[model samples]
Target: MLYSYAGHILVIDLTTGNIEKQELNEDYARQYVGGRGLGARYLYDLLKPGIDALSPDNILIMMTGPFTATGIYACQKYEWVTKSPLTNIYLCNNTGGSFGVRLKESGYDGIIIKGASNTPKYILIDGDNVDLQDASSVWGKKVSETQRAIYEMTKADTIVCTGSSADLPNPVKFAGVYDGHRCSGRGGLGAVFGSKNLKAIAVMKPNKKIEPKIYNPSGLKDELSELIKDIKKNEVTGEQLPKFGSIIWMDTTAQFGILPTRNYQDILTYEDIEGKIDTTGYGKKVVKSKELKAINCLDCPILSGHVVIPDHGEWAGKPTKGPEFETSWALGANLGIIDFGHIISANKECNEYGIDTISTGVAIGFAMECRQKGLINDDILEWGNSESVIKMIGKIANREGWLGDTLADGVRSASEKIGNGSNSFALHVKGLEVPAYDPRGVWGMALTYATSIRGACHLKSWTVAAENSKDYIPVSTEKKAKLVKDIQDLRSVMDSLIVCFFAGRAINKDWIVRLVNVVTDFDWTPEKLDEIGARIYDLERMISVREGITSKDDLLPHRIMEEPLNNGQWKGKKITKENMEIMLREYYKLRNWDENGIPKRSV
Candidate 1:
């Protein structure tokens, strides 16, 4: 008996229209655990080096962990693993929705999708029955429309689909896959879907649900009780997040002078735009509507998602999902716009079109900066132009006009195409756009962004909270290398467990190890878990290395390193090249990687 696992993997080859069930490898299950770690293990063994991410040979794995659908708090996430069409390297994007739970209940730990269908198709997993069905009827539809249509046709409990952005004549490289509002929102996995001529995946609720047999139900119950208490008592997971969603960080980021503005040309202070774009501002402008409310994933304690009805805009009175802190910053403050309604509308469009909000915002911000510098000759791509931002969203989604088509390829490729020193401020690390947090104010994030395997992702090693806490100095580079390395390893474990990142406050290493021990009957210590995390992260790095990534790729953008903040507490501060090198050297040494950022220990 496999405790806390479905004991099988569903393999689908779209080209051959074949479906096969392979027994889950018990040894791999124990070694890699599940989700990101397991997916990476499989991908490393199956994928050849230097294969085009959009080719039929590229594989996509949607994996659920042991804790998934086990009634564990915040264990609702599943990972989507593949070579990113945007970054051309290893990508592991995770999301929380009913889809993962339903997928698990359908009796498969994960689904490995390979080969390409000659025509549009959708995968239907209805209990024991699985088939590849023609998707010509819904190929060009938006995400929500395709989801609704698929649900209507099959009564699927959960459906994840790519929107029209992925189906465009020239698909947006930053396109994402959506399960309602929850998204695998980074790394252009949706473009990969479009390349395969795959539109959506629908999983129907099983007639007889497959629940993982817990090794110690009573012990698991006690641990869960403690976890719940921790969650309810902790200030972040308990009060702030639940009350303000992710927008609460707006106040913190602004107060700390880390609020990225005008494509990171400047950082905003609290006094600059306090009640306009901060938490209080969001509450007044966006959350005031009675139709707007906080929502949560399955068994999650923190209600971080907001469904809002904008008071004014084209989307007014329409109950659409609101933007998180990252999205708000990307679409609002980053572009020099503060109108909450416009930001909301922009976020809604991005979601509907199945594009990454972060990448889209940064791409537009890059264009706006380019226009200011006379590199781009377009008047519409100007800073603080909310209407223009909306217009560009449509253009980018459809690959409309020159500006739209160029920006659709992401800032890195866009800068290369429209060169005039634009690459200096592209604001990306390893081809992926940096998230809301400006590493200038939080020095630890400098290392975080530079070394993250999937590119400038905050979740991989979120040093912000720790660096922002009272115990640590936020601007100092001292000890940041160790801090980043430790956090990265821990996050690798969390992603493998498929636990929600927001729950990190309550669920520490001790708590996680306890949960795993009870559920899977594994006698894992905190040290052991840390080792496994390091191993998983190393394997992922190896995959990237095999694809030609070197120490040169592990770098911060020129803007982040060269340009200093002009205002606020962090004035004249920038993550210098010297600082980045010191951190990188220390990080590489910690990971047992060579000077070239290649793993020294063979997997």
Candidate 2:
């Protein structure tokens, strides 16, 4: 009998309105663990390569790990896995809100949704009773409005939904949850929902917590206490993160010259904009003005989320969840915008419109660059133009006009269509827009961006912290590969446990293994758990390969690899082709991939 698992995998076919429950295979759980690992394994087994990402054949899997609802710190998150319409490759987007815990407490390990519906619909899951109800009334509403509608109708506290943006003719690549703040906001998964005619999912509040039958409850309790203590003692998790949130990253990344600025043109020159763009400035201008409220996910001690009420200027009374590190970099330095209020307003707009801020910001930055170069004759798009940025956010989400349609597809596709030399400056890898970190400053991020299966992503393996550490040798590619691989494996484990990445910094490997063992009654060593991470990574890589990713696809954006930093700490530095090739060789060797980055058939 399973101890930590729900012992069931619920499958829903929206086309036929049919729901089926299948037993959770214990052997499968033993091999892949749960959450990301299990989700990837299932995708590999069930999904055919080259299926249209937005088609009915493409499936959406919502999964939770063993630690979810087990009182494990920051385990309230859940993953949404599907073929990405944005990248046309495997994608996994996770969120922390009330959804994962409520889902697990509803007596199901995860949800596998398949097939498109003929009409607009929403899934209402109340314990064993599941219904696909018509969503015609809520169909074209914004994210927050739709969520509120669901809550009023079902009295459900957790709702994951798409906005009218997803229903665009070209469709956007983001979606939101609950308060229109927390999001599964990448890879066009929201567009996939629109394609399937799925508007929202409502999981009713569970009457009682689904208590897992743990083998050693007392021992588990003791270990959890120790883990909490460690988390509290850590400077990042206990203090700065809770107080400043991820906003603190802006200062560190900027100091290191890794922050993407002016559309990847230069990392420095942002000193002038610091007062209006940096975290310190935001705290002084906004946080102190009776407007900042630190928020957190359920069971998270860090309180990494914040809601800022701006009551002083253009955004005189706007409350928004975040202009978090990535979003801030995208909108602030990348586009050269310095208005803090404008950034906050844009954040709220993205949430309501249901678009990924990173992608939206990056895409707009690309358009601004295109305008500067005279590639596009548009007066509205220019560097640091906050008004234009705000206008474009709505246009892109709705796919309103020629510019909207061009950018709604993101930087990659937009560049392809625009084609003046715009593609040269289009900063994307594997068709997904690059995030905040400028690779020329921190080299591990070079490898991280290149090899990420989900495209240019930082979350897949965030190694900037280590690369910036005192012990790290900045120029050496020798240890870079090993560092990236280790972090990826470690993050894989954390994702399965479904804990916040920040929490994992304090939660050690030994404690993680202990928690899993007590919960599942499985004798898993640290090495064994690490192996699962490796296995999951390889599986995702293989899936991407099946969808046609190769060493050729593992590349940094042109500007990042070729352009030297015009100024800052990394003034003369650039990631040359030779440097990147050397690192890729080492990374491929470590992963047991051939020179072409293809996994060998013999394993």
Candidate 3:
């Protein structure tokens, strides 16, 4: 009997309308653990090399870890692994919601989706019964509407669906799949759903409420009690995040002089954007709605999710999910929009449209910069134009007009199409748009973005906090490679365990090993867990390598490498090509990869 897992994987081939259930491999489970690691293993075996990411040959794997639905705090995440339509490389996107828990209750550890459906369809999983049903009724609806329609029809506990953006004739490349307001919102996985003609996946709570068999329930409980104490003691996890939400980082990043502003043209401090878009300003302008209380993921202690109503603006009194730090920077500062209400409204639009806020904001910001440089002739796409930013969101979602179609493909493709030396400033690595952080301000982020397997992502290895610590200089490159590699490996373990990254603050290595031992009955040490993480990371790199990733592709955007910051304490600082190469070389050496960034060991 599998202890903490559902012990089965459901495979669906849309082309043939075939569904099969395979027993979980015990050896594989122990080696890869679960979530991103398990999903990546399945994807690497099932997917064909050199296939277009949106093609039927590209497989989509969603897996849950042993920690999922096992009464583990903040273990609400599940991984979505596949080739990215945006970056044309390995993509693993995870989300925190009730969906993973519900799916686990439905008696499956994961579901592997492949092949294109003949027509629009949605997957319905209710306990032991699973089927593909017609989705024509909800085909072109927005995310919330589709979710509502499906929920009413099937009475499922959770529904994850793409919005109308994914139903377009040509889907937006940065389209996202949403579970309620929370989303797997990067790497264009939703576009792959469009290609497969998949509308939504609805999972009903099992009639019997299936529970995983815990090996040492009492031991687990005692450890969790101690962990709860640690979580309460940690400042980041306890007070700041719960009270202010992630927007609390707004002031911190600004103070560090790493806050991205106006498409990376400059870095701004809280004083610069105070009372307009700063954290204090957000709190003053956007009040939590009386209708909804603060929200948190399943079994999470921290209530970081906020639902707010703007006090003033066209969107006044309208309740929406409050913009987090990344969303605020991307849609507010990066696009030069100061009004907190406008940022909230734009965030709402992105959620409804099922588009990535980071990529969407950066793409629009890229266009704004292009227009300023005469590459784009549009007058409306000017810096600080909130109205234009909101308008462009609609255009990008629907792939409407020339600018819409170009930008919908993402900044890299948009820059390529609007060529006139615009590619020099195109802010992407491996075709994925850079996130909110300015790499020039923190030198470690330069290497982080360049080496990330999924593309330019901050979550892969968030070096900002470590680099900002007193022991390390944020601007220096010394030992950054080791720092990044260690964090990346640690994150892999955390991600595979499928725990919330925020929860990781309290759940350190000793806690992780103890939890794994009690839950799965595995006698795992910190070193063994570390080895598994490295193995998983190496396996993902191998998958990307098979898809043509190499040292040349492990690169930062030209702007990040060449453009020096003009404002802030780190003024005149830039990550030059030589600096990047040195980091890459050291990183490659640490990973036991060749000079070309390929893994030395054969699969």
Candidate 4:
């Protein structure tokens, strides 16, 4: 029987040493296109409702999409999905690296990994061949080091392996690790891998060149040409992003007086916004004035990377991926340290350590707030001390010392333990920490933060697109529900298409359909195709609802509600609880969700 381009999703049941490829029917692919959408569907199907998140029975899928490796926008992306050990809900982490491209070249769109291995093993895939190899020697290294050693062992194959051993004997044996540029860093997917006795998964390119599985449109070349031109003309994707990446937004976010300062105690912009911020937070500033080159992901041209900062702090002129606007805001203003160089240094170190810099920064910022309020000693933050901050990240990752052990629980759980009203300033929504944009100044973010499915994620649907930009009307609560819902569906479609968020202008629905139809032979409309996005988003929300998330869980920290911005452009602005309730109720109605933020069954 002929299958679509995706064909059978390779299923490897490591428990009984059984391996088989299961056909991916049209129904599965239609509702959940690929990557996150596909991963969500597969995991939700197999993972029993309310199962322990770290159980071997919990299915883990590493999936890609039809657009992967098609020379399209950001096609070099993949998703590692499972029930999150951290949040105990649908945890799908999307990473943009060469793994998916290699997998696609190996003639497969996705793989499902279930059951546990009896010993440390690595899943090696070269086209259709699969090998579960012994990984005893590779178990105890840091994440990046693990990647290098795995490559050497596998003869230069691209590897996605968990970093360091589970060190299963440690306090948080679940501190599982992995390597590659972008990571599924939020949820403990790595730990779930460790739980299964799986160390690494290397997707190798096949030696035998495989032909394309479906028909390619004769018009693909011309369509690509127009897309490139459209991308070149877009301002953020073209001009501003090229120079500053997301770093340019720092001063802008600061100007709004809502940049998550001092763990939400002060919405005030730091005095150091200009003095402490620099260009290195954007990409490889190693060459100095020799034309700074930004490190972009996959097929993106937005140049979200930054050059290195000159010697100022612990990391003096080290080349790195970034201290994007989110990292800078959480690590800098949120902590009251404005030294751009210092913040960049911390951000780089966190990435290198293979931890989520946003979470780490916010976690540390939470710790600092604890210190200021006398919950912990002041020695941890040590005024204007960048090295201490770096040291703190190391300790937290390793779960060392008292403060580090507490912080390893992350900001929310950690603050709750300290029990001194520290919970009020933790500034986290559902254990996962909040991102840069302060919801206080941008009232729309209040709903965005409170209702985001991924627990305070900005990317899920960055309403700031409508709030901050001149093209959008700010502070009008009327159309926000429709606005965020549309953008979210757009984001979902992009995730499935595996395209960058910047490609809406260039890669329109027709182009997307062409990319999909040509790749898989399914002639889907832009509207119908976009509906798949809505379905994926709804499914994700449904997973949360099943995991016990509801309207009561939808909340901004009490500090954001009661506290006011003491300084900067929009001083004294605050989000009132009454207005917060009004905003979310509207959003729920728009999303076809009940007042309690649960998806309405009638829809």
lDDT of 2 by residue, 246-268 (tens): 87788778777777677888774
| CA lDDT of every candidate | 0.88, 0.81, 0.87, 0.70
Ten-residue region with minimum lDDT total, candidate 4: 165-174
Ten consecutive residues with minimal summed lDDT in candidate 3?
A: 286-295
| Model 3 stretches with alpha carbons more than 4 Å out | 285-295, 310-316
Q: Assess candidate 3 and give its TM-score to the true structure.
A: 0.98
Which regions of candidate 4 deviate over 4 angstroms? 1-4, 165-179, 214-216, 268-271, 278-303, 306-318, 469-473, 502-514, 517-522
RMSD of each: 1.6, 2.1, 1.5, 3.1
Give the clashing pairs for model 1: none
Shift of residue 253 alpha carbon in model 4, Å: 1.6
lDDT of 1: 0.88
TM-scores for candidates 1 onward, in order = 0.98, 0.96, 0.98, 0.91
TM-score-best of 2 and 4: 2
lDDT of 1 by residue, 1-603 (tens): 679998999999999999999999888888888999999999998888999998899999999999998989989889989999899999999887778889888899999999999999999999889999899999999987898899999998888899999987567999999876788889899999999999999998899998888999999898888889999899989998877788988888887778989999888888876888777777765444443322357656787776667665566778776679999999999999987888888998898899999999999999999889888788777889998999999999999989899999899999999987889999898999999999999999999998898999999998877898877898887889899999999999899987888888889898898999999877899999989999999999999999999999998999889889887788899888888888889888888999999999877
Error of 3 at 220 (Å): 0.6
The clash count of every prediction, one per candidate, is 0, 0, 0, 12
